[model samples]
Target: MGEMSDTGRLVLLGAPLGNSADASARFREVLATADVVAAEDTRRLTRLARDLDVTVPGRIISYFEGNEERRTPELVDVLAAGYLVALVTDGGMPSVSDPGYRLVRAALDAGVPVTAAPGPSAVTTALALSGLPSDRFCFEGFLPRTPAARRSRLRALAAEARTLVLFEAPHRIGAALADLAAAFGPDRPAALCRELTKTYEEVVRRPLGELARWAAEEEPRGEITLVVGGAPEVAAERPDDDTLRAAVAAREAAGLTRRDAITEVAAEFGLRRREVYTVVHA
Candidate 1:
């Protein structure tokens, strides 16, 4: 579409999660111009190009979990040769619970310039639709496959205060939700988003216990993104006015600005800045 420079670059293309219309113009340009295309599923890439009415005439290489290790070096070599290399996964962006991490790292290590052809991602899509806490959240890709390991991982994450996002296969949906409820508590709020951006798209919002029961009975089908409410913070004992004043003073004496000291003290004790400000002034 534009003049091709001799400069080599690696572009990570974000594929539409499910709906083809989500393909952006920038993404199409990168796909068409890339000299070498490394795709998680070559067939799916071809189908996507067809859907978007964009022709990908570049050399297509299959790069998935099975051959990522073997194909990584080859991709790096091509990137080193001033080739415009583009990587695409079946759905969503590459490298997030998908192939392309090793290749990206390898390309960067080889001093090859790398960038992204941004598009919609299921993580944000589901999180937004779930109506869960969006400000502070962590995407935990997918839970461990094995039962024992998955349980252990959940145990470790039980006390995480940040909202949790994760992917789950249809078959394991029931088990995963049950384990989550056990680890995070039955009453913890959560939302299960499935078949996102598709005809049968559905978002089920409920507590962990209710979701677990629903999954067990209905057995959801399609790619699932789960958003779980963060663990409630433990209530902190409110320090007396003297203690708050002394704490703020100590922080200020340790080289913090008065306002910064007050902010830190308020956050530490879970008090509002205004509350601390009034207390200090009084």
Candidate 2:
């Protein structure tokens, strides 16, 4: 167990996503020594520490979604008292779509030193196993639960050029994949990584449409991390200047305003509205 400095520190420890062996030595050391251990799930944290042969002698407090708002200020106060305070979620880093953001923010505001013992992350793990373009990618967390909102969100990301990483519940995986296929187009390539770094782990890489079909037939289980390929580098078919102009002219002749004509033409050709406007005005 390491000793806390005169000035307290707020340490955010990254709990292992699945395998217990992934827990770092620093994680064990902090668990053994921190004055206050705030965990998303106390049971899960205890089990993890036990599996690592580490004992958490400090006070343990539940700091999950239900109590985070109420608990954050108290934890921050502990940090201000020159005691080392450690925060850990059920899995992964504290605040990546998890419950540690508020506590971290409060600690920083209260002038409590904030640090992290970074370890396993489902996001980066899935991305590495995804075999997708990881150079430029974004973590979308989880999609909206409602069908309308989920589809709307996917539609908004239809033109995203960077790879996308998302988390989804096992039961909702099928519907989400179906919605993704509808919004991003069936042919878009994607990888579905489920139960990563644990027993019964599965990674399925296929086109969105095919994956959706598979999910429909076979129910997926356990935690899910989806890595989807971005929109194509070049559209399969792009209308030439003459074709775009002709389409715009036809729409205008059919009683559509110039703006409406350009909008319609651009959507039809998968071209940007600004690009269509340029062509139409030219």
Candidate 3:
């Protein structure tokens, strides 16, 4: 709380997920200089400061999911008053699947400048170690806890062509993997990153079915991030109409109904089922 600057700004500081060494110099400087530090967990922030050997001289306030709605306005007022405010979470960046979204939106709406001291992120770390296609990917965060809802969500992403990144709890990892395998097909490749940046860090890469079976045997501990490969790319040269019709006929001869045969063939070649249906009927 030294001499306050004329203009205040909301600073989103990314805290390390596990390793203290991952904390950035900019993060330390901000912690020491900011007029106020709003943390998702005040206790965790205290420990992080101690580990980094940095002292936070300003007022430290708790800002987490439970109180984010009520606390956002208060922090926004600090920013409006020309006092620098830093927001940190228990681990990684704020608002990636955590608190800080409401506060950021409020700050932007209030016309207070918002910036970030970006540091280690579980999402990117997991993706980089995933060994899957990284050029294009999407972060799905956490899936629904309930089985039906979770399966429905996975089914919705069944046709997603970009690599998918998700966060899951250790307790639900097995069930989640099972749902993923069922929705995305058992052979889909995936990587499970556990305890990223920590001493006990581990990454398990395998087909979704295998991973599901492995998780059932033993539950993994620590923060978990999942990186799943996209649906297999469709061949650039689509099969001819005769080939499509023959494929559907093969399935139909194997005991599937004509409609089901078309659906299966369409999925196999990444074509629209309706298109396959038309070709088969023609």
Candidate 4:
């Protein structure tokens, strides 16, 4: 930890999701002042800097999937030399289905302090805009590219109870939706958000089947994000008195007030709050 100040730090930059205005003040500052900037697409980085009207005074280098393995150690060497290196992807955060994981891992392995100026993510954006329950959801990122592999993946996820979020290229949206419908059932509720936070941003909410047809008809363009509702949960049998008391006690031990614990336990157990209170107080 003490090496933080002594060693060069790795900054993970979250590029604007779609709007140049989404760039944070610190995001621009890092771009302008870092000793080196590692970008997935240096061309996109240049375009983004032009959009933001921010002149990057630092040296920029390509650090993408193709060369990530070879580039990681080189960046770590820069960090060892006490030069701040900021990493930026084409969009969103450096890594959440994007490159940067390898570099981050390598940096940490070398005891370099790493941090992020977090930015917008399509996973949560589509989930929030989808109107699906976000309290407990899963991000599946991009599914398999092939029909057989994609369907197999969806089949494995069919019984997942948490809301599922995924990304698909515009060209593959129709086929992906079709595979999703076939795997998860046609009636499953889903949403397709495209060109997020941009001039033509659009979100379409429909069942998996309808989304498939919509994609076929519209041939939606631009980046695509999909959020799907999870499978319905089967109700569990009610637990006994000791079990209820332990559940309440666990929440209270975890820093919840007794009242909040009761409320949460009741919601989970499908009981009135009064029932949990009675069990707790009893």
lDDT of 2 at 94: 91
Off by over 4 Å in 2: 1-5, 235-282
lDDT for each residue of candidate 4 in 111-137, tens digit (9 for 90 to 100)? 999999888888878888999899999
Candidate 3 segments exceeding 4 Å error: 236-282
Candidate 4, after superposition: displacement of residue 121 in Å?
1.1
Error of model 2, residue 56, in angstroms: 0.8
Q: Considering only N, C-alpha and C atoms within 3 Å, which residue pairs clash in candidate 4? A: none
Give one digit per residue, the lDDT tens place, for model 3 in 19-74. 99999999999999998999988998999899989999999999988999999999
Model 2: colliding residue pairs: none
Candidate 3: residue 274 Cα off by (Å): 24
Better of 1 and 2 by lDDT: 1
Q: Considering TM-score, where higher is better, how would the candidates rank from best to worst? A: 3, 1, 2, 4
What ranking emerges by lDDT with the best candidate at the front? 3, 1, 2, 4
* TM-score for each candidate, following the candidate numbering: 0.83, 0.83, 0.84, 0.82
Model 4: lDDT to the true structure = 0.90
Q: Can you write out model 2's per-residue Cα lDDT over 1-282, one digit (the tens) per residue?
A: 245567889899988889999999999999998989999899988888889999788999999999899988888777877899899998899999999999888988888889999999999999999898999998999999999999999999999999999999988999999999999999999999998889888999999999999999988899999999998776468878999999999999999999999999888877899998998778
TM-score of 4: 0.82
lDDT of each: 0.91, 0.91, 0.93, 0.90
What is the alpha-carbon lDDT of model 1 when measured against the actual structure?
0.91
Provide the lowest-lDDT 10-residue window in model 1.
Answer: 1-10
